[model samples]
Target: MAIKEGLRPGGRSARVQESIHSAVRELLETHQRSTLTVPQIAARAGVTPSTIYRRWGDLSVLLADVALARMQPDGEPANTGSLRGDVRAWAEQYLDEMSSEPGRNMLRDVQCSQTPGYCVAIIGAQLQAILERYPDQPGPSVDRLINLLAAPTVFRILFSAAALEVEELHRLVDIALGQ
Candidate 1:
């Protein structure tokens, strides 16, 4: 059955991917990223270790995919008309995610790993959403805006014990907007 399923397209592949991703998330809840093994993930996911290796090549690649999947926003960023409002809404969501224990762990693991591009991809998606709203306005570049909005929150998450204050987040948005 397993051999036949592997020979088919789409359906089995999708299920395997979903199962592996779920197993990764479930394991992350209790195990550190560095401690997770392919064999353990395969057991939890109900797939063979070869399936994971064949599909993802290595644990780093699998971890990258898992982090990217988890970082995907629940929905599109809110479009509140004004750029400031839109940015604030997005920033608030980003900060809220960063404040959670799971979010922090995911971010830390992804950032520390060789596959940091997953983190950058999430930020790029947010920047693209913001840019789509204001096609003509003269403002900071997408990269600059991403840096301005993300850097402070990430720094706080990495170094400080304090929660990111709402006012501070607004101020960061304002700074990004060059206000």
Candidate 2:
């Protein structure tokens, strides 16, 4: 049955890819990225190592896709009619995302990647998009402001497991806005 299902094309391949990505994510949840291997992912996905390799080439590419899926934002940014409001809303969203189980796991996995620059580039590109989306704010350094707001959440999630709340986000906004 599984083999016949695998032989089917189009939608079946998408489902298989999704399953493989999900299996990789679950494995990251249970184990460190350093411990992940193609064999482990294949075993967990109930597919052969050849299948994984045929689909993703190697573990890094598979892990990258899984990490991206895990880190995907829930929705577009909300504008509250003020720079402070928009930045705060964005910060809160980022904080919530960074604090999630899958988000934390993805961060850890990306950190362990041999080419961490790729992850950094992905993050930088997202930040750039946000700035492009909100151009009304007149600030000395928007990038610095974003870094300030995001660094704390990333730090807490990576090192301390601190629970981020709305108040903290508000405080960060106040600091960022110089208000």
Candidate 3:
């Protein structure tokens, strides 16, 4: 496995990393990213600050790592055998994820930090995977699809009080596909 910032792939070190990550997630649910401190996270994770420092360097690095980890999908989006079905499934899943408190918190942290485009990149990668399955179909490019799906969804999630309805997602997909 790939080592991350000198962290070994497994063993007690792996457990330590898991604990730290868990602590960060747990803390993030109730704490603002700017207010989180290494000592607080260490205490929550049952490790010393030096352990976190040794693994991730500082609070900013640790938060960035946590944000990136949270942004990852638990698994690949299901292949529904058709581009429309797959895109709709992916969009629904994405909407569900972003509507959660932790997801919003992570998005806020990533947006406010130096890695503002990190979430967009992650979403783009997911869209690219869906697009790769339909090489013969001619429609909007991956970037355009991302804009159609992500841009408005993120805006509504972060700004507007309105909920992202399922019909809206389908309409967006249809529009993107020129259907």
Candidate 4:
């Protein structure tokens, strides 16, 4: 079955993906990621190692897939009553989350994936939701915000010794907003 399930409920591929993803999540709760291997994951997932390789390419890719899935927005952005406020709040939140240990690991997993665009689209959709909230006002495009806001934040978190300060995040918001 294809790793990328159609998400059709109860389908064979969907069930397989679900079990595999669940198995990975379960194992991570008990074991260090460095200790995991294709064989172990396959055994826990009740699928063959060949199945995992054929679908996801490698364990890193599979972990990346799981990370991307987890990164999808749970709900709409916070409503702060103004585009600036909402955008700023979102940026601050983004910086906070992405700079953390787990978030950093997830970002690393995503970088190892072949489909980085999917992760970008996920973040873009999140920003789009914030943009949609204030339709009456002009705001930066999601692409622009990603370039100015998210990109820098991710860069600092991934490359720099420290994540952006809240002050820096605020400045990024100002720039992204063209303020």
TM-scores for the candidates: 0.78, 0.64, 0.77, 0.91
Candidate 4: tens digits of C-alpha lDDT, residues 1-179: 22255444568877888888889888888998889898999999999999889888899989988877778777888898999998888888888888888789889888876664887788888889989988898999999999998999999999999998899888888998999
Clashing pairs in 2: none
What TM-score, to 2 decimals, does candidate 4 have? Answer: 0.91
The CA lDDT at 68 in model 1 is 63
Q: Candidate 3: list runs displaced more than 4 Å.
A: 1-17, 28-37, 50-61
By TM-score, how accurate is candidate 3?
Answer: 0.77
All candidates in order of lDDT, best leading: 4, 3, 1, 2
Q: Give lDDT tens digits, candidate 1, residues 1-179.
A: 12222334458777888899899989988898789999999999999999999877788777766776677778888999978888899888888988788777766656534444656776878778887889887666777777887877888887899767889889878888889
Q: Candidate 3: which pairs clash?
A: none
- List candidate 4 stretches off by more than 4 Å: 1-10
- Choose 1 or 4, whichever is better by TM-score: 4
lDDT, model 2, position 78? 68
Model 1 lDDT, full chain set: 0.78
Compared with the true structure, all predictions reach lDDT values of 0.78, 0.68, 0.79, 0.85
> What local lDDT does model 2 show for residue 57?
70
RMSD of candidates 1 onward, in order: 4.9, 6.5, 3.4, 2.2
lDDT (tens digit, per residue) of candidate 3 on 1-179: 11244557789988887888899889877887778899999999999999888767678767767777677777777799988888899998888888777667666656534445666777888888888898988757878888898878878888988757879988999999889
